[model samples]
Target: MSEAFEQYERKYCELSANLSKKCTSASLLDGEQKKQKLSEIKSGIDEAESMIRKMDLEARSLQPNVKAVLLAKLREYKSDLNNLKSGIKQITSNSLNAAARDELLESGMADTMTVSADQRSRLMASTEKLNKSSDRIRQGRKAMLETEELGVSLLQDLHQQRQSLLHADDTLHGVDDNLGRSRRIMTNMSRRMNRNKCMIGSIIVVLIVAISLILYFKLSK
Candidate 1:
């Protein structure tokens, strides 16, 4: 658990212990003394509830592995707090009814006011939770949109690269065709040169033979 969460938990435990002692003490006292003790208990309960809220937020901020454990612990504490609150309410009702007949009207009015205050506190807590949830939803949506845009950009770049590769392939094929034509032309030229050389050799041989025969005839005459 985080340091902050531990601190809050420690503080809440102290407050709960103190409040329980005060509640037991209040049961034995009467009149003004009892009223004072109950008032202190109410204040203590409020402080403890605030500490629980802080602990819950800290637990949520923890690493996931520890966060689940802390959250579960917080839930147990909240349940205990609720049970404590119920006990307080029961104590208050008992004390209110134990009052003298003349004070009945005033005690009833006080109980109604206390109930209203509790309702308001619960409503405020609910509103805070709703706001936190809404913020988380908004953040998640924004992250998703950014991821989607990144995916689209990558796809577009891939398409462009594929087109470039296709163009290069076409260029290579054109180069290969030109090279093939050049090779065929060179082969034909070599063949024609060989044929011309053979014809030239035959003509030279014929000239030599005719010249030799003419010389012999002239000598004989």
Candidate 2:
């Protein structure tokens, strides 16, 4: 709450209370004095209404939560002001009837300081309802926050899972490459072994043919 707004709201409440007192007390005066007091109260009522409007604008400028609370209060104040406005009109008209005016003043003066039992009960009920509404709004906000946090956590988990899958895929590809290289090395070793066996067979056949020729030549001698 801005200091200026609080100050002005206090000013408005004071102005309203003073106007109410003046309206009730206006009956105590004579014809000329009563007329003057009613006129002054009328002017004060107008000032009070203007203050309500200014406070409404101030409430709009507040943060969302604060504004909600202030606007609710401003509405209550408006209702009270409207009641005062209506009462003033009735007072103005009734002032011409001396007897009726006297009766109203007697009752109004006492009622100013006192609330009837029913009225107090209703006021308490309204306050309780307002508190319940506030609690529900707070609970809704908390739920939304919790849901948002859960969504963020899920997204993080999903991202980590995707990264792990990609790493596993890379590992599989590396193993496949190593297997292909080992297969090629085995093929080359097999071919070299076949060539060595063929060369050894050719040398043995040549030795056998040379030894047969030496034995035939010795028999001829």
Candidate 3:
């Protein structure tokens, strides 16, 4: 009976140690997974920041208010992402240690229970933060997309307006040139008509004078 009790105790200890190690490893895996998720969220935020920067530059060169709004949005997203990062760090660092593991393990199969509970709590908190970050990033992306579309439409409208104005200007200039040419031709014709009238008046005056003198001579004879 004594020997049997000793064997049972040894087996239980061995099982406890194995279970505790497995739980620790599981916790470690959960931490790594959360880190990966955090990295993915950070990547998304970075991409959004880059897009916002590009939009801002375009808006600066093309539109003022648009640039300002986009820049402001970028700042807001960056701040939110920083908060998410802080939360992730806190959750990941609350890891269970060896003493806690051994005590929980020896407490009759509660080792797995305690470790699982801790892992679940940490995972849940980190996952929630990561999800929130993702949601914000998605929202930001959507807003940027809308902004880009609006910008493109505005640019197209401006281009069309410029083209129309240029065309109208060219037509007006052509008409003005034509009117100037017509005015010059009319002026030249008027000057020629005045000279011809003067010449005809001089010839008529000389003929009248000659006829009157002939009549006078005949009468005197």
Q: Say which candidate scores most in lDDT.
A: 1
Write the residue-wise lDDT of candidate 3 on 1-221 in tens digits.
12332343234334323322332333345445645654554454455445444544543553464455445544554554455455435544544343455467788656587676866776666556555655665676567557657765776898899999999999999999999999999999999999999999999999999999999999999
* Residue 94 in candidate 2, Cα distance off native in Å: 28
| Candidate 2 ranges beyond 4 A from true positions | 1-124
Higher-lDDT candidate of 1 and 2: 1
- As for TM-score, the candidate ahead, 2 or 3, is 3
Q: How many residue pairs clash in model 1?
A: 0
lDDT of 1 by residue, 1-221 (tens): 37888799779878866766676566555578878888998999899899998988898887675676566667666766665676567556656655642264466644656654654554454345434433443454455446546655766797899999999999999999999999999999999999999999999999999999999899999
lDDT of 3: 0.56
For candidate 1, the lDDT comes to 0.70
TM-score of 3: 0.61
Among all candidates shown, the one with the greatest TM-score: 3
- Rank ordering of all candidates by lDDT, starting from the highest: 1, 2, 3
lDDT of 1 at 160: 100
Clash statistics: count for each candidate: 0, 0, 0
